[model samples]
Target: MALAKLGEGANTGCMTQTDDSLRDHFLVASPYLEDAGFHGAVVYLCEHSAEGAMGIVVNQPLEITVGEVLDQLDIRRERPDQPVYAGGPVQTERGFVLHRTGGDWHGTIPVSDRISLTVSRDVLEAIGRGDGPRQYLMALGYSGWGEGQLEEELASNSWLVTPADDDLLFRTPDESRYAGVLRAMGIDLNQLTNTVGHA
Candidate 1:
């Protein structure tokens, strides 16, 4: 996985139009996907193009708190302790903010009409002051794929992609996100198998 600074805005050069892009979608790891980093991961695709795709693993929470991060950044902690999520395997030290679109912030990229991705410090500052977007997820790092890489994985059935919903992204519990996505797709987890078959 290649990691880039989210604060630099998205790298759109490599992106090309496909029949349909997965932006503003949810990628649920298939049962056959054995990569420890992605197993059972439910990623929210913020950007996708021929250049590649970038997303955050919404279900994996690191053993850190929002208050701790604010303290480290010297931002006054005014909110209660919130769990910080592990976005993905790339750039573990970097941060990405996934939130509802409305608040103005530096380096904010609208993923869709309803959601946005921001990496600037100003949003974090606002969050610390309780004036940030009403709904936000603070993630450290993100998942990235090279051009055509994500499509290849999709062809191999490594992921089950679905349109994202606000409930799944912001309201669902992290631990149940993977299954919740599957349920939203009308798939039962108990009946799923590792075998991939073609007609």
Candidate 2:
């Protein structure tokens, strides 16, 4: 949602990726994306097949009420409580689950057969009642790539491919996520830049 932006509109400088291989990779926005939701962002690639690519911004946390989202689905929580995450720049009203599978959950998107995304309000209700999945995250909206868009950006050095880690998803705090990923890469925060074409 707009909360992820903390800005007034879409970034005029966001580079589109144009390579096939980079589709399933992650985009760690350079220090140059420092004015909005993308500032120091770390995106996780959810799809990278021939058709298209998709992901979610992992670092930005929103101030929205998860209960509000549940209510939209007509599911009520006996005791509402759970943090909401900024997924990306698509349908902010829709719900997406980035979590481990099982335990009475429904309406999931299979990121991998082993790992899935459950987006229905039932999941949220269960979570609010302390009966949610073993581990999960609620994301509103998502980042999408069409055809050659991701490839173009990857060729320009706009993203980095890394294995998605559960610890990074569930344990890291919002403020430090992007920096943490860079640290894992043995790169210092001072070394990245927004100039993708030259990188």
Best by lDDT: 1
Q: For candidate 1, lDDT tens digit of each residue in 51-140?
A: 889899999999998778888888886883778899998888888888999887866777889998888777888888989888989899
TM-score computed on alpha carbons, candidate 1: 0.89
Model 2 TM-score is 0.75
Question: Which regions of candidate 1 fall more than 4 Å away from where they truly are?
Answer: 1-19, 193-199
- The C-alpha TM-scores of every prediction are 0.89, 0.75
Report clash pairs, candidate 1. Answer: 14-51, 15-50, 15-51, 16-50
Candidate 2 lDDT at 18 equals 44
lDDT per prediction? Answer: 0.82, 0.64
lDDT of 2 by residue, 1-199 (tens): 1112211122212224445444334578764343376666788776665556778787777886666666655665665556678888887756676777566554555565445655555566676676877677777788887766766666665565576666777788878878788887777776565343454
